[model samples]
Target chain A: MNNEKVWTAGLVVIGDEILSGRTADKNIAQIASWLQVQGIRLAEVRVVADDMDAIAGAVNALRTAYDYLFTTGGIGPTHDDITVDAIAAALGVDVVIHPQARAMLEDYYKDKPGGLNDARLRMARVPDGADLIPNAMSGAPGIRHGNIFLMAGVPAITAQMLHGLTGQLEGGAPLMVETVGCWTAESEVAEILREVEKAHEGCQIGSYPFFREGRTGANFVIRSTSRDVLESAVDTLCEALAETGRDFTPGGI
Target chain B: MNNEKVWTAGLVVIGDEILSGRTADKNIAQIASWLQVQGIRLAEVRVVADDMDAIAGAVNALRTAYDYLFTTGGIGPTHDDITVDAIAAALGVDVVIHPQARAMLEDYYKDKPGGLNDARLRMARVPDGADLIPNAMSGAPGIRHGNIFLMAGVPAITAQMLHGLTGQLEGGAPLMVETVGCWTAESEVAEILREVEKAHEGCQIGSYPFFREGRTGANFVIRSTSRDVLESAVDTLCEALAETGRDFTPGGI
Candidate 1:
């Protein structure tokens, strides 16, 4: 087993649209995938309402628990956009307009119909002593106050912020995963799955059962920091499934 | 504004697939929408890993904070499926087999191959003093202990569990929402939204920006428990947008 220190991150998805089911959230998956590429595990995620206290509570709880904390949503140019204020409160810092963010927004919106007005300038506000994360899709940038990153609620804008943060944070070895899919009920082979996982050191197997095409099947996902350990676990699981006279797919269903 | 005590729920999504970005979670929206229909607000959500400590910690935190707590995932037959154990630990109870659940599972697997093995029997286990929430999609029922409900990770199964739970929970009045979509950027209408919300006694407006068809657009979701307040807020918002000379869609984009 690798003895390297593992880095973890927590995500706070700030939006009433998500909690109210008015909008489906895509940022959690997007950010989780991006963090995986950065070799940091997404340890936890909280979907909070647009309320100031809710956002601030999640920010405070997660920021101290993980190595880094990223928040998406409620950062737009409207009254509902209170993430900047909430995060600032959580960190006990005053909100301030970043000079660079204001400059960028001014240049971008200058040619538009309505120039950078008071409402539009709200995008430039950030927690005190924060750096700006460049937004490729929109001129208003993302905010970074210490280990906490405040991103836009829109998935496209959050993607740009994540891109700007690539290769910037320190992390351990990226987790490796291999999945084996079977056309049988996982409960029928639950013992086999348990034995294989027990035999493989440093590897954890997760069985996800599904009902599709009028049949029961499951995908066994094996994850590990060591590629060799992950591969071995998959091989053992596949061989065990084969011994039970069941067909298995290597890349999953 | 109504002085009725509002009912709130906290959802704990327990799975490694969600945290790994291997599976996009549909339960948060599903449960959120369902809770709304039940006149209960989904106040918070936590996507936690399959670890026992993680699940137990979230369970304890949320179960006490809200009127009710619901959890999805990690209740399968596999070793990694430790949600039952974790939840039991959180409630300070012993794990035991529910006779009704065992009978249900036995009947469920009787006609299939490998009928009712030890692993399949694992589905019958629940925390002491728990009742079963019927799973219409699958035979293994969901467990309900006090205000905490443990459901399946699969959307279909979770739907069945939620259906069984409909009209059973005590809640306040259902929140009503009216959306207004506009082709203009939401930033241009920020003040208008704030003004509309402030004018309506019980209404709250949320701005969701979207970039589509090579143009900027936004959907303003107005929510209120009172029908009069919601309709009035929407009318004022529409009139405000019209005054700005921008076209708006009442039902949203």
Candidate 2:
């Protein structure tokens, strides 16, 4: 394996609705997938409430822990949308309305009803020294303060913001993955999986077991920064499974 | 509002697949909803990979931070399933095969082909002095080590385990909720939501906005420990929406 730098990012999903189970969070997976393609590993995720302290605490903790910190939710114009304010507090900065964002919102709402009222104009507010992450889906742009990104809670808007951010950040070698599925109990091959993972350098395997159709089975995912190592590990695991008289699928179940 | 002791819980989701974006997490919502019914608030959630240190760190942090701590994933029979070991390390305890869990698994797998093999028996392992939380859906029971719980990752299995645990925990008065939906932009009523929540001493209001069918709308949820306060807050919000000449739905849109 090459001694390449690994970039890591931390995500903080800010929403009380998520904690209340009123909203099943889509941002975690969306951001994780997006970061993976950017060659950045999503090292950790924290789901916090809409409260200002909670949001600020998570942002501060994650921003210092990872190369990048992405916060989703609470960027809206409502009272509960306190992410920008919280993040500002975390950065020891003052919140101010950005001229560019204000102009964008004015243009977007000029022909529409309600026409940029106080609540709608609240979207223009950002941290004092922050820049904007373009939002293709809506007029409200995302805030980019230092390495921290403040995004929309709406999945569609978050997607647009991420799309606009693609290829903008620096990344390292992307992790490659291979999956092998077997129609047998994972316990039946615990020793083999452990030994194979131990033998492989820079490669880790994860076993996900499932019970379906009155039968037990598992899918093993092999991941590594090097494709050759990942493939070699997968081959060894496949051989071991075959030797045990277990039928295995290459691409998983 | 009556002064009652509030119970809070934290969840640590341990899985590489979740962080890899290969799996969309259902356990967070499931556990959150279950905890709500049990009157325990899900205070925070952390999603970490399958690494032992990550799991142990999250477990130790959350277990100490909240009244109760629950973990999902990495508790199966595979080598990668190290939640039991991780939690044991976090609690400074030795790993032991619980005799009761072993007997239960033996009885459960007697008619199955595997028939309680060494790998399958691994499911019986728990931290020394830990008790079993019954699993009605599968053979492997959940682990209850003091105030910490280790549950399965699969949503179906987690649901069954939670069902087995319902009404078993001590909690405060359940937070009552009332939702008001309006086919108007949330920003348009931001002040109203803030003022209503502030006027109600014991209540909190969350505004969730959406854009659908070429129209912007929002759902406002009012939550409080006292039913009277919750109802009063909802009434005030509804009246404000009416005074603004906006049509609102009582339940949600």
Candidate 3:
């Protein structure tokens, strides 16, 4: 592992609808994108059904393996919403209603009629020792353990809770990014690309192939923490490609 | 964990572009769909870069966890094509050109000019003691060893290989499916669902919510091997929903 303050996270998507192919999982892609901008790499993502044993197993493994674990789904007001119990089991704890959570629900439903029924109270059953993670969209808040953040299954609610939690996270320094517009096949530019990668330590380069308007091209993106290192590497790459009679348009720094 | 015959498979998605968000992986979704249709449960999936060690680690872990493992990506004739060598390292063996694979490629590129160069021959390199799995789209074949199916990362080629390998696999009987649709407020329909699930053994029932145009509805999809069992459960579900003043529209069985 690159010990350079890399905070890796894994996502656990708990829903039978996803495993049954009735619903496509939108959380994985959403979380992956959000984490990338914060310089927190999403290491792995697993979509398990609402099965208790499967959820517990995945939650345990992911929480132990990654710096952070985020789970979406099975936290609604229905009988299938067993995520709280499963997480408690995984952590070898018990489900207990936190007073703060109860107060939040009370305040949220105080305005609405027939609010906070027995079924709705299920949403307040947080795992022992968990702190409330605010849900900006709805009154039903998420929960967070040491590094595991448990949010609702619905996309809108999940996005809202994640947005609320983003500001509280510790992010690494700006990871420099540079891109060059495509002109040729990825394979044709591999040899010199490998040499450039070898020359630039502490940097990673990726090649992306694209097609638009009956033309195929690739963009070479280089990322690092050091701007000088990135610039020098991009210079070498452009020079080498130009020597091979291929030109590219430089993009964002 | 069920005492019945269970077929488990794992997926390996190889490509740094996916991790960098330059490319979204489609192979996992395609393979996962095919596996679900065959009564084979997809146990897990790992996405790794084209780096040799990362690919090797994922392939090795998945190979041991499930009954079969399938890998996509890193099989093309590009410089990043390291899946062959990675699989070899994972299995503690060496990769060599298989005669059958070489013949298939030779016949495929016989008419094309400058076809089957050393770069292209890189596709024929299979781990020692592996059988060639046919690639129907392009002639460059995939390889199968024990429970591992190594396939191309390209969507079209991967789908073609999966089709070719279909006849060779042994799978459980197709799981029977029944859907009770257009139920409003899934939480109110939970108790009856539990009772129906208990009555029907060896069946899995899932509730899917769909909200569109300011209307919220749900589908209760039930799966079981016995048609009679599923019908009885569906009948009870419809009867129970009627009591809640929500008449379920019974579609074709």
Candidate 4:
């Protein structure tokens, strides 16, 4: 992953189903992975209900705080789906149907068996001035304005829209990661752990405690932009773990 | 579950492991379930890295915005576990060794070797004026300061602490949920759907379209605090779906 660019992204998962735990959101992970490949880091993720005030507050806060903000859900062709109006309210703009969006829908359903009607036409309503994001899975396109990208909430469609959208973004350098797995408690490796952190000042070293089948251990992942820096930090970590007579194995990039 | 209490809760899931996709945090789901059982709605959830600034910002924001805030992670003995200090910083107070917390640890390790040392005692440090929430699984108790409850990130230990802490909270009236599952497209059910919504003024309804096992349909979940209102809404929804020759099953409490 590239880490050279200074791009940071945040996710606003808009849906009451998600907050109620009735639906498990997959868009956050999908977007985070796409951003990683594009060298953008996903710094924060927030889940809010479909309430207008909550949606507006999250959209405004995240759009201004991060370099890119991606929202999924509430952009469907039903009355309960109010993402467009809520987003317009967040931007303090009047919601209006865009002509280009309507034309796109007209062209999309011109040959389809299920003809487009007023209900289907609801998908064409977009906040004023937002650019359309082509949805490869389905015809109804996503909309983007400023730093916020509004996409469908369905996992497959969201992934397709994100795949097409990433190409349009300028990515930072991908982050490099190296890990050493060992069956030692984190506290046992504390002394040399501090030294490793101090030596790799440019990298982030994290110790994650894990337990499986009654066994307890940790996986230490060292991350940095520079390969040499990450490798050197892993070497130090391995040596430290070795001194404790602990079993350690190197993991992939 | 009572909704009359009018209290809201938020969750803060700490740890870079989750943001990097190395681990899927379970604390949010656990806390959400616990809060739901108590009739306290979980208003929002934030997943952030282990950085002090991120943790502090989330803690401060959630504590102020919601009636209660619960945080999970960064409470281990390792150097990377800095949640105690971060919570203290969020409260703009100094971290102090609470006598009750120290006593709990003392009792926990009284007969064990390598008992509470200076390093291990670090777990006993908490924000000033905070009360301890006993951990049934492990002796390292969680700390509660007014509305904010700080607990361990481990699933088992977090569950234990939350169970001990729930009884102290004032619960809102239980949220009532009703669902109608039907094999109808969103566009096909648009007109009567709006009528059902307009007729039910107090409840909120959500339409979720899903394509599972080669079938296409949607599920509408109607939620409210009053059972009578929810039942009437569900009845109206059923009648509307009946007009379209669609079937629905009642779901949820």
Candidate 5:
């Protein structure tokens, strides 16, 4: 078992569209998956509206609780874009325009209409003592203040931000995952799943049940830092499902 | 402006799958939309792992901050389904098997291959002093302890649970919404958005920018509790966009 200190990150998703159900959130999954690849666990996520108090409260709580904290949304060029200001308040620092960010925006928006106006210049604002996370997809760059990363609400731009940050942070061994599917009710095989997880130290299994085509099925997801332990758990789960006369498949259905 | 009380809710999403990015959650949006229809505001949301302390901490924090609290995931028959125990710990209640829940499960699984075994019976367990939220999709009914709702993680099952409880919780006026789209950069209309929002007194306008078909566009979403205020804000926003000579569309692009 790997006894290394686990690095964890928390995410704050700021948007009224998401809270109002107008936009389905994609950043949680995107960042969570990206964090797994970075060997840092996505510890917690808080989705708040575009209110300064709400954003600052969540930012302060999460940034202190986890090793890294990331926020998405409210970073655009409109009046509703207050993520930078709110984050600056949370960090107890003043918002300032980074020279590099201003230069990048000036160059990127040079040929475009409404070139670098006050509204567009809002993109250059960041918390004091922060660096920029380049957004190859858009002109506006993401802001990184210490361990806090403020990203765009748009999934594609956030992807670019994650790309800019790939493998930049220190991390432990990347967690490995393996999934097995069974054409039986999870309740019928709950004991099998528990026993397998208990037998393997430092491994956890998750059971997701689904109803499709008038039948109930479940996918047992096995995860561990060690590939050997994860694979062994999957094999044990499959054998148990086979012995119980339930058809099973590896890598999920 | 409607000065009446604003009903609010907080959600706790519990799952390692969500944190691991294996599952993009649907419950937050579903519950948020449902709360809107019920005239309650979805104030904040926290997504935590399957750990006991994590679940309890979020459950306790959210259950107090809002008029109501909802939790999704870990209410199954698997070893990882510790939501019941965690909620009980948070509420300082004992875990007890509800007679009605057990009866419902027994009848539901009577003719099945495994008829209400110990693992399957786990569904009947609930915190003492809690009531069951009927799950029309599955036999395992959701547990409701006062204002804290413990729902299934599965989207469809949670939908059924919501359907069963609709029109039951007391809420204020249902929030109204109007959306306008423009085939222009939001930065070009940022002043229009801010001015309109300020004039409306109670309405909020959110600008969502997107890049599509090699051009940038934006959708301005106006939300308010008063129908007249919302419509007036929308009309003013459309007029402003029209004056700018930007092609604008009602109901979004």
Candidate 6:
């Protein structure tokens, strides 16, 4: 099954705006997709408020539980930006202004108004003994402490930080996925799905049901580390659906 | 500060699709917004996979930490729809087919093609001694085991379940919000934000920065339980912004 070598990561989304429903979170999906491309499974996610205690607690728990931990939000240049401080507290380290980050901020803002003031300088702070993750989209760079990555809350900036980190992480085999769509209700083929999945040793199937255009249907997504196993599972599932006289589509509806 | 009566709820988003980044989660925003209207703060969130142990662990942890715990996903009519069973395991209760749920399913599916088959009947299973949260969008009712609610993963179905349970939960004072947008960089007014927030009792200010139209701006959201306090804080922030000679907008940019 090759489950022994699977790499997992956990994400901590730090913000009150998300928990308050004021901002719809885009980082979860963005980071999850990014982790998949890295062959790292995103095992869990915790969205906490801006409170120092909350952020520290989540960071401590997630960082220990997974191979990698990623956090987004509360890294801006305002009073509410406390992610660096909270993460430092979690790691039991001192918060220090990185020389490279300070240099970058200085060069970027020297021509702008309010040139590298105290508030702007806050963006250069990082946990002690941490390296910088280049932010090509903004002047403030992302922070990386050991296996934990601290990123921006803004989706675009986070994307740039993630792009900077591409191919830098060690990962196991990437998961292969195959999809099959059935026009019939999933309940009618629940037993078939289970039996097909059981027959495949290394594959898992997820059924996502949807009601659209006055009809109900579902897409079965089969994922496995082995592409051959995933393909075999899909073939069995399609054969079972055909045996049940249910009309099915190959990819999805 | 009216903190004594503040109500809280935790959400456990149960879906592999969400963790896999195949589907962007809508339940967190929907449930968070709904809880806010009910005057209950959405305190924390955990997005877990479809595995039984993962779901049960999150359910137990969240249900104990907050006044209410809501789970979305894995409550459909398929083999992967194992939320009812997982909740039962978490609660140390036996999984039983509720008579009322079964009757509802029969009535709903009588005119449909699959007339309440075994796979379809899986939706009627619930943790022992639990009640049902009506689902107007689908036949499968949401499960309510004490303060733990198991809802459908589909956004529309989850919304329907949430709608059915609205106004049924007890909560404290709803938070009131007032926002002021400033054309200046948030770093330039970081001191102002910190000072204004410190002056206002029971009020918090959050700065959200954005870059648009070749200019950097930020929206400051002031929140408090008391409307008078919120308005006063807004007035102080606006006055401070004016004092800085920065052009400001009333609502947001």
Instruction: Tell me, by DockQ, which candidate is best.
Output: 5
Please provide, for model 1 over A1-253, each residue's C-alpha lDDT reduced to its tens digit, 9 standing for 90 to 100: 6789899999999888899887888988999888988899999999998888998899999999999999998888999899999989988889998999999999999999889999999999998999999997889899888999989888988888999999999988998888899999999899998888898887888999988889999999988999888888888888888888999999999
Q: By descending lDDT, how would the candidates be arranged?
A: 5, 6, 1, 2, 4, 3
Instruction: State iRMS for model 3.
Output: 2.9
True contacts kept of 1: 0.78
TM-score of each: 0.99, 0.97, 0.88, 0.92, 0.99, 0.98
Over the stretch A133-170, how does candidate 3's per-residue lDDT look in tens digits? Answer: 89865678999988899987878788889888875777
Candidate 1, residues B158-179, lDDT tens digits: the string is: 9999999999999999999989
lDDT of 2 at B57: 94
Question: What is the TM-score of candidate 6?
Answer: 0.98
Candidate 1 chain B: worst 10 consecutive residues by lDDT? Answer: B73-82
Model 3, runs deviating above 4 Å:
A1-3, A106-114, A174-176, A179-183, A208-219, A247-253, B1-3, B103-118, B247-253
Greater-DockQ candidate between 1 and 2: 1
Residue A209 displacement (Å), model 5: 0.7
Candidate 6 lDDT over residue span A1-253, tens digit each: 5646889999999999999898899999999999998999999999999999999999999999999999999998998999999999999999999999999999989998889999999999999999999998778999999999999999999999999999999998888788899887888889888998899997889999899899989999999989889889988998889887888999888
Off by over 4 Å in 5: none
- Tell me the tens digit of each residue's lDDT in model 2 across A101-124: 999999988987779999888899
Error of 5 at A117 (Å): 0.7
Candidate 6: list runs displaced more than 4 Å: none
**TM-score attained by chain A of model 3:** 0.88
Q: Per-residue CA lDDT of candidate 3, range B45-69, in tens? A: 6777678887888888889988889
Evaluate every candidate with DockQ and list the scores. Answer: 0.86, 0.78, 0.34, 0.50, 0.90, 0.85
TM-score (0 to 1) of chain B, per candidate? 0.99, 0.98, 0.89, 0.90, 0.99, 0.97
Q: lDDT of each structure?
A: 0.92, 0.91, 0.77, 0.80, 0.93, 0.92
lDDT (tens digit, per residue) of candidate 4 on A197-229: 888867888887776677767788888877888
Segments in model 2 whose C-alpha atoms lie over 4 Å from true places: none
**lDDT (Cα, tens digit) per residue for candidate 2, span B174-206:** 878889999987877888998999999878899
lDDT tens digits, residues B55-111, model 6? 899889999999999999998888888889898999999999999999999999999
